[model samples]
Target chain A: EPEVTQTPSHQVTQMGQEVILRCVPISNHLYFYWYRQILGQKVEFLVSFYNNEISEKSEIFDDQFSVERPDGSNFTLKIRSTKLEDSAMYFCASSGGWSYNSPLHFGNGTRLTVT
Target chain B: TQLLEQSPQFLSIQEGENLTVYCNSSSVFSSLQWYRQEPGEGPVLLVTVVTGGEVKKLKRLTFQFGDARKDSSLHITAAQPGDTGLYLCAGASIQGAQKLVFGQGTRLTINP
Candidate 1:
């Protein structure tokens, strides 16, 4: 089965540095999403992208955060300036449709650690 | 904001025992989904229940959506060690965009 894949399973960066998390969603999937889970906290939605534009975003996805499908296959999330609170497991997901019938498929995730 | 509350944040039982995890919310959802996550991995979809009073079974695991569409439950019969993992419930709101609201999760440990 085709699955979403994320690179750099673990990322460590300085507080003020910029970092980019990379993901390759399922080849045939249409909608892409980014979600993060703080340690011991509920997973929170960051952003959703479809038709090459952002469809929705949460408050946590502020000025520092941005997402782009630089190419047909690679979707990237970049944080302009990292903060301690930004540390978490970031998951990339994709779905063939937005409804329940097309359930989301997720990648293992990228563990971002800011110090 | 929508919130999902999961009961008995942690559960530990011997193999062969049956267990149920509850996910509740004050707000209604258009659809509810159950996911299981192993350590260091993303949540994997187990089942999706869209209609009120809907029930779906995956092997020994049974999932049910509330009649009011505000809660759901996962029941595992004759559980095994492989069932040990973090179970999370997420709901899609009737009015919100395509983002899912997740619960804190229930950690299950099935002992041999």
Candidate 2:
């Protein structure tokens, strides 16, 4: 089955440095999202993108965070300055339709370690 | 606030036994999804329940949505050692982001 794919299975970045996580959603998917899970914690929503604009975002997504669909296939999340709290598994997901019941296909995820 | 809460955070049982995991919330959802994850891997979708009192079964797995649409459950019958994994429940709200809000997760271990 076709699935979302993300780059860099694991990353370790220095505090205050920038990091970019990349994802290539399923080719036909229209909606995209970014979520994070701190170790042993619940998965938290960060942001959602659709039609080339941010459809929704959580408080956890402050000014330091930004998402871009620079091209047709690539969706990227950038953190301006990494922090210890940023150490978590960042998941990228996509869905072909609008219904909330539509299953969102997720990438294996990029594990970020902010030191 | 956490939109979903899963009970019995951890469970261990002998192979061939049955067990159930629950996900509860005060808020109503447009849908509920169940996922399973192994260590260091992203969650893999198991099933999605959309209607109140809906029931779905996949092989030895049974899933149910609560009457009020605010809760859901997953029951596994004759679980085998391969059933061991982290099970997570996520809620998709109708009015909000439509972003899935996940429960803390229930870790299950099935021993032979």
Candidate 3:
């Protein structure tokens, strides 16, 4: 089955440094999302993208965070300056249709470690 | 903001046992989804329940949506050791923004 794919299974960055997490959503998917989970914590929504722009975002998705669909297949999340709290597993997901019924397909995820 | 509260954060049982996990919320949802995640991997979708009082069964697993659409349950029968994993529940509001509100997961371990 087709699946969303994320690069760099694990990353370690220093505080105040920038990091970019990349994802390639399923080719036919129209909606994309970024979510994070601190160890042992609930998965938290960060941002959602559709039509090459941000559709919605959470408080956790502040100015420090940005998402881009620079190409037809690539969706990327950039953090301007990493903070200790930014250390978590970031997941990339996509859905072909409405979330009400269509299930979102998730990538294995990128684990970010900020020191 | 909407929130889902899952019960019995952790469970461990012997093989062939039956167990249930619950997800409850005060806000009604257009749909609810269940996912299973293993260590070092993202959550994999198990099932999606869209209608109130709906029930779906997949093999040894059964899912139910409450009449009010504010609660859901997952029951696993004859669980095996392979059933061990982290189960998560997510809710989508009726307004349909495409964003999901996730609950703290329930971790289950099926000991052989």
The global C-alpha lDDT for each of the candidates, from Candidate 1 onward, is 0.94, 0.92, 0.93
* Tens digit per residue, CA lDDT, model 2, A63-104: 999999998999999999999999999999998876865678
Poorest stretch of ten by lDDT in candidate 2 chain A? A96-105
lDDT at position A107, candidate 3: 95
Candidate 2 per-residue C-alpha lDDT over B26-68 given as tens digits, one digit per residue, 9 for 90 to 100: 9998889999988867888999888899999989999999999
On residues B11-99, what C-alpha lDDT tens digit does candidate 3 reach at each position? 99999999999999999998899999988888999998989999999999999999999999999999999999999999988645568
How do the residues B33-86 of candidate 1 rate in per-residue lDDT, one tens digit apiece?
999998878889999888899999999999999999999999999999999999
Clashing pairs in 3: none
Residue A113 Cα positional deviation in candidate 1, in Å, after optimal superposition: 0.7
- What fraction of the correct interface contacts does each predicted structure contain? 0.73, 0.60, 0.77
What is the per-residue lDDT of model 1 for residues A1-115, given as tens digits with 9 covering 90 to 100? 9989999999999999999999999999989999999988999999999999999999999999999999899999999999999999999999998878888899999999999
Q: TM-score of chain A, model 1? A: 0.99
User: 1 or 3, which is superior by lDDT?
Assistant: 1
Cα error, residue A26 of model 3, in Å, equals 0.6
Candidate 3: lDDT over CA atoms?
0.93
